[model samples]
Target: MKELSTLCYIEKDGKYLMLHRTVKGNDVNRDKWIGVGGHFEKNESPEECLLREVKEETGYTLTSWQYRGIVTFVYGEDTIEYMFLFTADGFEGTQISCDEGELEWVEKAAIYDLNLWEGDKIFLRLLEENHPFFSLKLVYDTDDVLQYAALDGKRLWL
Candidate 1:
């Protein structure tokens, strides 16, 4: 079944809020560090999902954010996910512990040191480059290795 999700990189100072997905036993992101997000709930738009997820996971109400892009992930053969990507620089609230895993404010320059998916690196670069709103498609093999990638309908070299 196709899935819809939202991901947000909440920025503060020179760091981004990162989630270490180690709590879920069967999580596809287990042991990997990623931005805050989750699968969409019924009837939730991208913005709604983003807001709800950020609050539930971080106890923050976003006051300023930008829609960064859309990512289409083709996982092996059975699962396809459309994820809305966002970046937020303004929010209000105190931090809270997440049941999903550890949350940390990772320095931008050190984000590469974290265990992350290859496909994630691709999009992270796009975010770093401050690319305009884009559409990225990432195709992965059964082993979770990136096999193909395209940006805005054009194939990317890596």
Candidate 2:
């Protein structure tokens, strides 16, 4: 299992900083507007991963962030990714476009308009509600359909 982590940076104005990626490789979330982050290196914690990834991709030094949720990524027969999701509200420095994609500040009210994965949509909504969500384990079947999901051992917010 490959452990991956990501961070969602929210500005004081209720706008979220996101990355627009192109589908030129085998990345599962390629060609999507998603958070800026990557896999964790050895001996690095989730916080370290988010801070480093944000700085590397957007040239920002992150400060305030909260652990929002976790997701299990199932890709084909030989790949499984354990992902940790985080939300940040403060950072320093200017944003810059990275080789991964362009960077943009998206309003909180308009996040649903972007091309996001179904799982992302769910937790993004949860984050907006200011609720405390511990974890969400989603299972994607062979056909890529989210056949089952156990959220905090109960049904997720409907």
Candidate 3:
């Protein structure tokens, strides 16, 4: 199993900064909207991973970020990846498109309309509720169905 880290940057206008993935593939989540982030390279901290990813993906510099949650995906017999999720309210630079997809500012109220992982929506809702900082561990099965979820470090409604 390998672990990955990602950052979810929220803009100051109460909108979420997201990436619209246009990659065509068999992955069910492809061609969908996702957070601006990716897997971390060697020796990269979660913050470093996020800053680099945001810069690479949209040319923005993020700040005042806080760890929010972790999600795990299990595929088939032996595939697993842990995703570290973070949130931020401050950033610099204008948005730019990347090879991954187009960058968009999704309104806070309409985020549910976009195509996103079911478990991700849950965490997104948590972020909107202003949980401050916390960690969520979500387990998924081979079929990409959620199995369980647990949290630590803060109290959340979900």
Top candidate on lDDT is 1
Q: Where does candidate 3 clash, by residue pair? A: none
Worst 10 residues of 2 by lDDT: 1-10
Tell me the whole-model lDDT of each prediction, alpha carbons only: 0.95, 0.77, 0.75
Model 2: clashing residue pairs? none
Separately for all candidates shown, the number of backbone clashes (residues 3 or more apart, or on different chains) is 0, 0, 0
How well does each candidate superpose onto the true structure, as a TM-score?
Answer: 0.98, 0.88, 0.83
Ranking by TM-score: 1, 2, 3
Ranking by lDDT: 1, 2, 3
Candidates 1 and 2 compared by TM-score, better number: 1
Report the lDDT tens digits of candidate 2 across residue range 19-47: 88883486666777888888888888888
lDDT score, residue 72, model 2? 75
Question: What lDDT does candidate 3 reach at residue 111?
Answer: 84
Q: State, as a TM-score between 0 and 1, how close model 1 is to the true structure.
A: 0.98
Per-model root-mean-square deviation over C-alphas: 0.7, 2.1, 3.0
The residue-by-residue lDDT of candidate 3 on 41-68, one tens digit each, is 9999878888898888888888678887
How many angstroms is residue 136 displaced in model 1 relative to the true structure, after the best TM-score fit?
0.3
